[model samples]
Target: MSLTLQDVKRVATLARIAVNDEEAATYQQHLNGIFGLIAEMQAVDTTGIEPMSHAQDLSQRLRDDVVTESNQRDKFQAIAPQVAGGLYLVPQVIE
Candidate 1:
C-alpha cells in the first residue's frame, strides 16, 4: 500500500517518534517497500503445504535428567533472620 506524507506523519505521531519532513518521506518510502513485499508474499498460493518447525531434518539430543546438586535448604535457612516450618517470614507491609 502507498503511504502519503500525512499518513507517515500520523504514524510517527502515534509511535511517539519525532520525524522531520525529509525523515517522514524516507520512512514513507521504506514502509511502502515493506508493504509491497508483504503484498507480494501474500499473493503466493500455499495450498496443502505442511508447516515445518525447522528447515533441516534433525532431532535434538537431550541429556539425561539427573540431580547434580545436593540439598542446601537447611544451610541457607540457618542464615535467614526469620524462618519457620522451612519457610521465610517477611513483615506485613499492607494493613
Candidate 2:
C-alpha cells in the first residue's frame, strides 16, 4: 500500500496538524517508502525461522538481593507529631 497526496492531507486534517502542501508531499513520499519497505519485508519467507527477542544475544548482569541498611523507621517516627498503630497520621486535605 502507498499513500497519495490526498491521503496525507486528509490524515493531517484529521490529526489537527498544520501541514502545507510541500510538507504533506514530503510526508506522503516518506510514508509510501515505509509501506514499500513493509511490503518487501512481508514478501520474504520465514516459515522455518524462529522469532528472536533481540538482534544480539545478551544476558542481564544482576547483583544478589540483600538487606544493606538497618531499620530506621522507628527512629524517624519517634520525631513526628502524630503516631498511631505504627503509622503516621496526617490532616485530611480532601473530602
Candidate 3:
C-alpha cells in the first residue's frame, strides 16, 4: 500500500484540492506512512471476536408511559385573542 506523488496528486484532483508540487511531495510521504500503519494493523488476526457498541454493558432505564394531562381547556383558551363557539379563531389566508 505505497503511495507516490502522482497518486497523491490524483487524489487531490479528485477531492477538488489545489496542491503545489512541494505540498504534493509532502502529502505523498504522509499518506504513505498512514497506509503503512493500516497495513500493519491488517496483519493482526482477530478470530472469534464479537463487535461491541459500547465498552460497558449498561442498560437504558426509561420512565413508564402514563396518560397524565391537565384538562383546563376553558381556563387556557380564555387568553386567546379571538374565540368563537368554544374554539380559537385565526386569520383566513386562502382566497
Candidate 4:
C-alpha cells in the first residue's frame, strides 16, 4: 500500500495536475493511506451479501407508461431565432 514518487508523478500526469516535489511527497502519503483503506476493505468477508444500489430498504414509485400526442409545434417554433418548414435552423459550421 506504499505509494512511490513515480506513482504520484504518474497520477498527476493522468489527472493533468502540476505537482512540485513537496506536493508530490504529500500526495504519495495520502495515496498510500487511501490504498491502505482499500486493502482493509478487501480483507472483509462478504460471501453471502447481496449488492444493492441504495443502503436503505426503500421502493421507488414509478408512473405507468402512456403515449400521448402534443400539438405545440407552432408555439415552440415561434420562440426560435430561425425556423423553416417546422424545424429549427442553425448556422453552418463545417466548410
Candidate 5:
C-alpha cells in the first residue's frame, strides 16, 4: 500500500492541519510505511491460534470481600445543610 502527495494533502485539510509540500511528502512516506507493515501482518496465517487476553501467563491477586470499616452515615448526615430519609437534599435547577 502506498499514499500519494495529494492524498496526504487531502487528509491534512480534513484534519484541519497545516502542511507544506515537504511535510506532505514526508507524511505520505510515513503513512505508506505503516500501511506496508499492516499488509505484512495481514499476510500471516493463524488458523489454530487461540486469542489471549494477555501476552504473558498471569492471574490477578484479590483480597477477601469483608467489611473493613464501620458505618458513619449518621455522623456525616448530621453535618449536612438538609437531609431527609437518609439522603441529602439539594435545590433543583431544572424544570
Candidate 6:
C-alpha cells in the first residue's frame, strides 16, 4: 500500500498538525517508500527461521550485589524536627 498526497494531508489534519502541499507531497513519497520497503520485506521467505530478541547472541554483564554503604538512617533522622517509632512525622493536610 502507498500513501497519496491527499492521504498524507488527511493524516496530518487528523493528528492536529499543519502540513502545506509541498510538505504533504514530500511526506507522501517518504511514506510510500517505507510501505514499498515493508512489502519487499514481507515477500521474503523465512520458513524455518527462528525469531531472536537481538541480532547478536550475547549474555549481559552482571556485578555482584553487595552492601556498598554503612547505615546512615540515625545520622539523617537526628537533624529532622520530628521522629516517632523509627519514622518521620509530618503534618496531616487532609481531613
lDDT of 5 by residue, 1-95 (tens): 68889999999999999999999999998999999999999999988999899999899999999999999999999999999998999999998
Off by over 4 Å in 6: 61-95
The digit string of per-residue lDDT tens for model 6 on 1-95 reads 98878889989999999999998988898999999999999999989999989999999999999999999999989998999988999999999
> Which tens-of-lDDT digit does each residue in 1-95 have in candidate 1?
79999999998999999999999999989999999999999999988988789998799899999999999999999999999999999999999
The clash tally of candidate 5 reads: 0
Measured by TM-score, how close is model 6 to the native structure?
0.64
Model 1: ten consecutive residues of lowest lDDT: 49-58
* Candidate 4 vs. true structure, TM-score: 0.58
Candidate that beats the other on TM-score, 1 or 5, i.e. the better one: 5
Cα lDDT, model 2, residue 6: 94
Residue-by-residue lDDT tens digits, candidate 2, 1-95 = 98889999999999999999999999999999999999999999999989999998888999999999999999989999999998999999999
lDDT of each: 0.95, 0.95, 0.91, 0.92, 0.95, 0.93
Deviation from native of the Cα of residue 85 in model 5, angstroms: 3.7
- Can you write out model 3's per-residue Cα lDDT over 1-95, one digit (the tens) per residue? 89878889999999999999999999988888999999998888888878789998888999889869979899878988999999899999998
RMSD for all candidates, in order, please.
Answer: 3.6, 2.5, 3.2, 5.5, 2.7, 3.0
Off by over 4 Å in 1: 62-95
10-55 per-residue lDDT for model 4 (tens digits): 9899999999999999989888999999999999999999999899
Stretches of model 4 off by over 4 angstroms after superposition: 14-16, 61-95
Candidate 6 clashing pairs, residues 3+ apart or interchain: none
Positional deviation of residue 64's Cα in model 5 after best superposition, in angstroms = 1.4
> All candidates' TM-scores?
0.63, 0.71, 0.62, 0.58, 0.71, 0.64
